[model samples]
Target: MISPHKTLLSRFYLIGVVATIVGILVVAILNLATPLEFIIAQLQTLRQGGEFLWIHVVAYRFAILCLLATFACVPFLVILRRVLTPISQCLSLKNRQQSLPPPLELKAKQRLINLPFIMAPLNILFWIFIPLCIFGGTFAIDKIDLAAAITFFIRSTMVGFVSSAIIFFGVESHARKVLIPLFFPKGELSLVERTAKLSILKRLRAFYRIGSLIPLAIIVLTLFVLYLQVNAETVSGKTYGQGVLNFSIVVFILSFLGSGILNRQISRSIADPINGMLDTMEEIKRGNYQTRVNVVSNDEVGVLGDATNRMIQSLAEKELLRDAFGRYVTPEIRDEIISGRIPLDGEFKDVTVLFADLKDFTPMTEANDPKQMVQILNDYFKEMSAAIKSKSGLILQFLGDEIYAVFGAPVSCKDHPSNAFFAALDMEKRLKDLNKRFVQQGRLPLSHGIGIHTGQVLAANIGSPDRLSYLLLGDAVNLASRLQTLTREMDARIIVSAETKQYLPESQTRNVLVRHPQPVQIKGQQTKVNIYLIK
Candidate 1:
C-alpha cells in the first residue's frame, strides 16, 4: 500500500470505512423498524388473538444479535483492508517506474477496474450470512416456533440484500471517481482487455432489481404470508390483511430511495467522461490538433476518447510534414504533386525558361566578406523569387548569383512567354526600391540581368533513383543561359529571344519593348537569333 499513488488508495480506504458505517445504519433500520417488528406483531395477533403482546421478548433477542452484528463489522473492515492492500501496492508502483513489465501494468489496471465487480459478490455473500445469523440466534435463544423462524430469515435476507446493494455501488462509485484514475490514467478503457465491465445493461438490471423487482417481490410474499395466517379466522382477516399490505408498501418505498442513490452513482460514472471527450473533440474540429481528449474511463466512451486522440496526433504529424515539404518545392508545385494534378514522369513540352545573373558576381565576391556576400545574394534572391512567382513561375533552383525559373510546364500558364517577360519587368522595378534600402543600411546596391526563351524541353523528375529532382532538359535551357551572358556584351539589363517575343501580349509589346539593333549569335546555335531588349 506504500506507493506514490498511496494518497488515492488512502482516500478510497477512508471512503470504504464511511460506506460500511452507512451500510450498517441502513441494515439496522430496515431490520428493526419493518421485518422483525411486523412479523412478530403478525404472529402475536394470529396466535394470541387480542391478548397482551409479548413482542418485547422477541425484541430482546433481536437486539442482542444486532449488537453482535455491529461488532462483526470490525473484522469485515479488516478483511476490506487486506483486499485493498494489494491494490494499493500495485498502484503505488508507478506505471513506468523501474521499467515495470507490460503484463504487470496491464494486470494492475485490470484488477483496479474490476474492483467494483470484485467487491460486489463479496459483499452479497457477507450480507447473505446475516439471514442464517437471525434464524440461528433467534430460534435457539427466543424459542420462536417454525413460522416465526421462517419469517425472520426471509425478512432479514431482504433487508440484508438492500445493505449489500448499497455497499457494492458505494465501492463502485469510489473506484470510478478515485481508484481507476490512478491505475488507468489515460482512460484507454478498451485497451484493458478481458475484464468484467459494469456496462449500462448491468446498471439497468440493478436499478430494476433494487428499485422495483426485489422490493415488490418482498411485498407480495409478505402479503401472501399474512393471507395464510388470517385464513383460519374469518371475522378480522380482511381488515388485518389490509394492515399488512400497507406496511409492505412503506418498505417498498424505502428500497426505492436506496435504488435512487445507486442510480445517481451510475449516472456520474457514465456521463462525466463523455462530456469531457465531447469538449476536446470540438477544439480538435476547430483545427487545434494539439488538444487531446481526456480519457477517464475504462468504458466504451473511454476507448472512443483514446481513438480520437490518435487521429488528432496523426493530423498534427501530417501538417508538420507538409510545412517541411514546402522547403523543397514551390507551394504551387507541391500542391500539384500532392493533389496528383501533375505527373512526375518525363514529357516534352514547349515552355519558356528564364535565368537571371549578377553581371560582375566574381569581382563582387572578391571585394566583400564571404558572409556579407552570401547575405546580399540571399536578400536579392528572396525579392526576385517573389517577382517571378507572382506570374505563376516556379523558381527551379538558386545557383550562385543566378535565379533559375520556368513557366507553363509543371503548373500550366497559357501565356508562358508573357508571364516570363512581365516577371523580368517586375524584377527590374523591385531592384531599384531594394537598392535604396540597401544603400541606407550602408550595404552595396545590387543589380542583375534576365534572359527569357521559349522552346521544347523534356521536363521530368531526374537524378539517381535514390535522390531525384524535377528538372527541365534541352537546348532551350542552354540558350537561356547563353542569352543571360549576352546581357553584358549586348549592354542590356533584360533580354528576350525572338521565340519568346512572338508570344508576348500585343497590348504591352508596342509600348514597353524595343527590338535589338543586332542579330544575337550564340555558341551552340547554327544561325543568329532575333531578340528583344526590355526598355
Candidate 2:
C-alpha cells in the first residue's frame, strides 16, 4: 500500500498541475478571442521584405514556449517536496519522535516557508521578462513597428503577471495548509523568528485583497489598450471592438477563478483556528486541563487562544490546590467546602468525635533530645493519621501530642461510629508497629489513650472573619477529650461512649468487647455520661 504522506505529496503537486492547466486554458481562450483581422494586419505590416507566414510561425512557437515554461514548475515542485520532506516526517504519527531532530526540523521548516517568498518574485520576473524578450526580440528582427512592439510587450507582461500571481497564491496557500502544519503542528509560527513579524492572517488578507483587484485592473488596462488600437491610424475600429469583447470575457473568467481561490484561503485562515479551539474546549470539558489552544496569529483568534491557555492554567492550579488542601482536611470535607454544600454558619449533626493523646508524653519529651522527640512525634502522627484516613475519619486538629478526629459532619457517613471504632483499633495496631521500630532503635516504646463519642454537635467554620477553622462545637467534643483524660484513671487504652456504641451496627457491636458501662460525670457536661472501656 502507498503511504499517506506520499499521497498527500502527490495531491499537492496535482493541485499545482490542475492550476497550471486552468491557467493555460484561460490564456488560450483570451488569445483566440483577440481580433484575428488585427493580428493579420500586424503580420501584413511586418510583411516588409519577409514572408507573410513568418509572424504566424513565430506566434505558434511563442505559444509552445509558454507551455513548456509553465510545465517547468514540475521540477520546482520536486525541489519543494525535498525541502518539506523532513517536516512531513515529523508530522507523521508513526515516525513522530524518530523524524528529523529539532535543529534539522527547524531548518527544514524555515526553508519550506521561505521557499514561496524567495521564489514568487523570481517566478513573476521570469514570466514577465521571458515572454517580453522572446516576442520583442522576434518582432524586432522582423522589423515590426515600434508601436506594435510596445503594445505586444505591455500585453504579454500583463498576462504573465496575472498568471504568475495565480501560481504564487496557489503555492503559498498550499504550503500554509499542508507544509506549515507539519513543521509547526501546534500552529506555533512564533518559533520561526523571521516570519513571526509577518502573520499568516495579514498575509492571507493582503493576498485576497490584492488578488481580487488584479483581474479588474487587467480588464481596465486591456480595455484601454483596445481603445488605443481602435484610434490607431492603421487599425479598424470594428475589429478592435471585437477584440475588446473577447478580452473582457477572458478577464471575467480569470476573475471568477481568482475569487474562488481567495474565498477558500480566507475561510481556512479563520475556520482552522476556530475548529481547533472548539475541539480543545471539548477536551477540557472532559476534565483534561492540560489542553491548550494553538495561537497561530496575532488577531482576535490569538487573543482567544491566550484566554483559553490562562483558563486551563487556572483550573490546573486550582486542582493542585484542592489536592494539597485535602491533606489538611479530608477529601470529602474539602469537596463539600468547594461545592458550597457545607454551611459556614453551622448546623448540628450527630457526628462521631474521637481524641487520642500520647500517654507519658511530657516525661518522654523531658528525657529525650528535642530533635529526637520531634522525630518520634512526627512518626507517631504520620502513622496514626494514615490509620484515621483509611477509615474515612477526618483529622480536625493536632494540639502537640494530641489528635482530634471526627467522622461524619461536613459529609455524612452512615457508619461513622463503627468507622471511628475501627480507626481507634487501627491506631492501636499502628502504635504497636511503631513501638517495635522504636524498641529496635533502642528507644522507649510509646503509648496513647483514645476516646470516641457519638452525639449532636455544630460542625462549621469558626473564628474571626479574617481567619477561620472548621470545628466541632458542643459538649460531645469536651466529653470525648475528658474521656481520653479518664483513660489514666480507668487503666484502659480505648474508651467508647455508650452513645457511640448505640450507633455502631449489630455486626460491629457483637465483635467489640466492652467492660461494664459506668455513669461518669464528664468535665463541662451538666449530666453524667455513660462510657465503656474497649478491649
TM-score of each: 0.71, 0.63
Task: Summarize candidate 1's per-residue lDDT along 1-535 as a digit string, tens digits.
Answer: 5545666666545544555555555544444444333454665565764333455645665686567556646666666667676565565565436555577767767777676666656655655576577667778887665565675567556655665566666676667776676666566777777777666667678767776776777666655555445544443655564556557566756776767777787676677777777888788778788888767555677677788888888989977887766654468766787787787798888899999998787897999899988888878887898788788788788888898999887877788889899999999988988889899989888878888999999999999989998899999999998998888887888889999988888788887778988787888998999888864
TM-score of 1: 0.71
Clash pairs (backbone) in predicted model 1: 3-92, 189-298
What TM-score number comes out for model 2?
0.63
lDDT of 2 by residue, 1-535 (tens): 8766666656556654555455545554554455544565664566763775776767875798566556546665666577556646655643445546777666666765565555455555655665567557867787554555565556555555555555555665566666655655555454465542335567576665556666666566656555555655655666566667766777787678766666665567678878989999999889898888866554467557777877888999999998987886667778987898778788988899999999999998998899999999999999999898888888989999999999986788888999999899899999999999999999999989999998889988889999998899998898899989999878789998889888777785676647555688777888887887864
lDDT for position 382 in model 2: 93
Candidate 2 Cα deviation (angstroms), residue 307 = 1.2
Give the residue spans of candidate 1 off by over 4 A: 1-11, 14-73, 82-111, 139-237, 240-248, 325-354, 357-374, 388-393, 399-402, 406-423, 429-445, 453-491, 496-511, 517-530
Please report, in order, the local distance difference test score of every candidate based on alpha carbons. Answer: 0.73, 0.72
Stretches of candidate 2 exceeding 4 Å from the true structure: 1-264, 275-291, 329-332, 463-467, 511-517
Q: Which 10-residue window of candidate 2 scores lowest in summed lDDT?
A: 189-198
